[model samples]
Target chain A: MSGKEALLEVDGLKKHFKVNQGWIASLMESFGSGEPDYVHAVDGVSFELREGETLGLAGESGCGKTTTGMSLVKLHEPTAGDIIYDDQRLSEATDAEIKKFRQNAQMIFQDPFESLNPRMTVYDTVAEPLRIHDIPNETARVQRALEFAELLPAEHYFDQYPHELSGGQRQRVAIARALVLDPDFIVADEPVSMLDVSLRAGVLSLLDRMTDEFGLSVVYISHDLSLLRHMCDRLAIMYMGKIVEKGPTDQIIENPQHPYTQALINAVPVPDPGVGRDRVELQGEVGDVIDIPTGCRFKNRCSEYIGDVCDQVVPPLEQKTEFEQDVACHLYESAAGYDPYEEMSGSPSAAETGDGAESTPADD
Target chain B: MSQLEVEDLEVYYETEEGPAQAVDGVSFELEEGENLGIVGESGCGKTTLAKAIIGILPDAGYINNGSINFKGDDLTEMSGPERRRLKWEEISMIAQSAMNSLDPVYTIREQIVEAIETHRPGTGRVESDEIVTEMFELVGLDPERADDYPHQFSGGMRQRAMIAMALALEPSLMLADEPTTALDVIMQDQILKRMGSIQEEINSSMLVITHDVSVVAETCDRVIVMYAGKIAEEGPVEEIFNRPYHPYTIGLKRAFPNIRKSSQDLLSIAGYPPELVDPPQGCRFAARCPMATDKCREEEPEAHYENGLRSYCHYADEIDTELRPYADDSDTWSQTAAATDGGVEE
Candidate 1:
């Protein structure tokens, strides 16, 4: 897909929440000319989602994957930057435009139990989005939504409350509710994390079907890299509110250049008993996001870091290799000059393809 | 001789509907210092079995039938005071959620001290503190953090503290239920590695119950696959993963995704687990089993041992050839897309 086919483009997005340390402390900090504390949730992250392509945003907890997803759909206002949807800048859109944008860009939350209103029946829950969007035929819209969500024969689940359905069924209801407005793009934030392993596949398959049937562009945010690799077409690895690396799913997993990405991949356990892979245990806990250090956000834990270069200058995200691999690490910079693609061409790995190497078809 | 053996264990909870059979006729053994993993889906009676072993089942739950033989002593035959004395002195438990297990009000030191005091009545405060500090170092937690409350610690740290508390009494057996479920990948690895090394140091047997097969593959010596409160397969971890005899075990292994094999599509078991209450008479898994036949519906398969592994299946002998073919063919197991009935029947 070309740039014109891009459904959503997030450019230098940042969401920083002010840390309220009492009125007195706030006043003192303001008067003392000290730096105000802010939780830099999504700090200068940028990516684009092609139409009908499921782009997975993966990171550890508190790494701002959720924050990025929330900001993209306007659940939380961006501190700075722009969200371009269908060639329209959401940041510059009016309230009415934003509302219309919401109708097109829906979200499926993580916890089905908590996300659904207990007081509302499955029918009402699924119909709420339709009602909000003011579809001409409410009943027909609700029925179609339920049908598409695989809550078949709609009447069976129509009268049943959220408490009455199992975890998988409740999630199906959640998906139905999200798809009620026939959204073109959806943000699924850890949708299967809460469900049991047996139930997770069902929900994942459902999402996969929905994406294909609706031709929806999805931002699948999760901590599970393995699951993401299975579902997503392209992936972006996030660390401390930045997209440290982004590329096609197979390329990223087959050969991850970033130290953090490598560590994350190594941590995933192989199912084969004969295959014993080394477990790369990260050195320390993820650092504080409140006052992040300059230069590389992952410098503290990166084993490949080379001293002051990581501490002195913030590395701009430069495209490496002919492949769409973009990385923000000084180590990738050439010694002679700053030929980003030199390191890329030096390696003969399968990941270095500039053009699309269709090794495997999209499985899901 | 087996170090610990549970025979025909039946633990039930008195719910509003009636008695819910949480653990029904479960039997297993663990040798001294051996790591045994009990794998199952949610509500599969694995946790309940762990609780019964540790003598921590709630007041409403009762053991209707079974014999828990630890060493030579029958734990089920012991009196209330005897059982109380046996706890911590012989066996201890680590709950699934560390956040709720640790007392929020007390410091980590105080909690360990309290456990030591209760178990070892004559131990002085200074001696207990020394032991607590030693445990802190053993679990890789900073000794200075002993005085810190549960809230001050991270999730992984809290779990380490719980492990320290369990070790304070120097129990012979440790029952950890999904200890690393809520933790991140790095933390989970650290905690599991610590637990494995600690088990070696103390030379205590462990029973780890978790839903994640990858965890079992990594940390366990022997694994028992449970389904609907019954043992589907039991074998060494390597065998269970490599040459799984039971259909369910094969299905589970196929379903799980691995780092090395990132390209393969993740296979999912089609049907949900059978309900425990009023479960099918013959084989509990017959409903979802691909190789299930009329014989499976009429009579339950008995445990058949072959090559030092046990499996309850009608065609355990055919596992060498037939198992893989059936398991690999995901289409064979896919149930009709009809939505089944919901809610537990009374």
Candidate 2:
């Protein structure tokens, strides 16, 4: 994927919401001319989504994967930086231009039960997007979308309300609504996490097929790395609203270059009973995002953190492999000397790689 | 004799439509110091079975048939007072969702103290406090935090509090129903390891009911795969993982995401679980099973034993070769659907 093939580009985005102060505090602050405290939900994150390719954004809860997705679709205005869609800067675009952009970009929310209107029927639910986009031949479009979502013979399901449908069927309706416009890009924010184990696979496969069929780019946000490896072509691991590591799915999974990424991989439980790998347990809980650590956000929990360098300054995402893989860790920086990719050639086999892939030094 | 035996257990909910048979004719036994994992999807009656075993099913639900024998005493036949006496003394349970299970108004100490006094009367406050402190330390929680309310603790710590409460009496068997479902990966790992170590320490058996096969694989010694109120397969953890007999077990194993092999895609079982109200004839898993045959649909498969593993599939012998290599598929939709619906079914 090149820039021309990219459907969405989010560059150095930030979203900070001002915390409301008490009345007296507000009055004091107004008189003092002091800056109000802001919740740093998203801070200086960047990524690109290639047309028809699924890019998974993975992190622990409260790490801002959801906020990043919301920011991309303009649900929350960017505090700074630019969002470029199809070569057009979304921040500078006119209302008409933004409306046109909305037709091509849509979102599939985490909770289908909450997202769908209780009062509306399945037919109306799927048709709402088409109506907003002012799509012609509304009924036909709704039926077509339903068919695409694998909810066959739309007539049987059209008049049925959301509560009437099963969890899987309701999710299908949600997907249909998202896809009815034939959008070029989608932000699937934990779409299948709320569903049961059996239903999760059905919804996941549907998303996989729809991506290929509709030529839609997707930014799949989830905490599950194992699920991401199955669906995404590439993935970007986030920590405290920063892209800690980004690469091809195979490379990231087989050769994780960041300590946070390594911890996540190790933390995931393997299904095989015969195979057992030593899990690297991180100390304490995820630190508060309000007052983030100065250097690497993960330095406190990192197993390979050396010393003062990790505490003194932040690490920049440096190219660790030749194949577009980047990681922001101090250990990767010291041994490999900035970009580790220059010394290595072609991608190694998944079997050849091990946990050492993430042990590299960070770039300042 | 087994420490706990559940025979022909049938629990039903009184719905407007009809009686919903949640755990129809489910039978299993747990030996002393053994961990038996009951694995299934949502609404497959794993939780209901757990609740039934502990005599804590909802008011609307009732045991329509079958008996629960704990330490050779018929739990189903026991009187209310008799059951109360036996409740947390011999058998205890760690309920699902510790966040909701713990009372919001009370401190962790108060709740544990109430449970201890209710079960084992005449025990003084000093003795109860000593036991509570020991349990808190056993589950890796600081003893000082016992003063804090449920809301004050994180989800994992609350779960530890629940476990400590359940283990206050040091019961012979523990029934944990999806105890780690709502917890994050790191928390889940700690909670599971604690439960395993605690089981060993107390020399007690446990029945861990969960939907995640990976959790069962890591924590359990023996695994039982259930489908729509019936046992599909039961075997040693290694045997089931390495060589699954039933098609449902195979599908489930493939569906679970493994951290060791990151390249493989999760294999979703193709169809929905059969409605338990009027479950399908023969094997309940036949509708979604890849290896479903005429015989499979007409007559339920009898449990067959081979190489120390037991499976409830008519063609378990023939399906072993087909079931292997399923976990490695990067895209399961095409590969899994292709394998079973092709040669074997014909």
Among all candidates shown, the one with the greatest DockQ: 1
- Candidate 2 residue A330 Cα shift, in angstroms, is 2.0
Worst 10 residues of 1 chain A by lDDT: A355-364
How good is the docking of model 1, by CAPRI class?
acceptable
* Candidate 2, superposed: residue stretches over 4 Å from native: A1-4, A20-36, A320-324, A334-364, B262-266, B320-346
Off by over 4 Å in 1: A1-4, A22-36, A321-324, A334-364, B318-320, B336-346
The clash count for each model shown is 3, 9
DockQ values, each candidate: 0.46, 0.38
Give lDDT tens digits, candidate 2, residues B289-328: 6556688898988988886788988888776656445433
TM-score of each: 0.91, 0.89
**Candidate 1, B23-117: lDDT as tens digits:** 88888899999999999889888998988887888998889899899988998888888888878778988887889999999999998998888
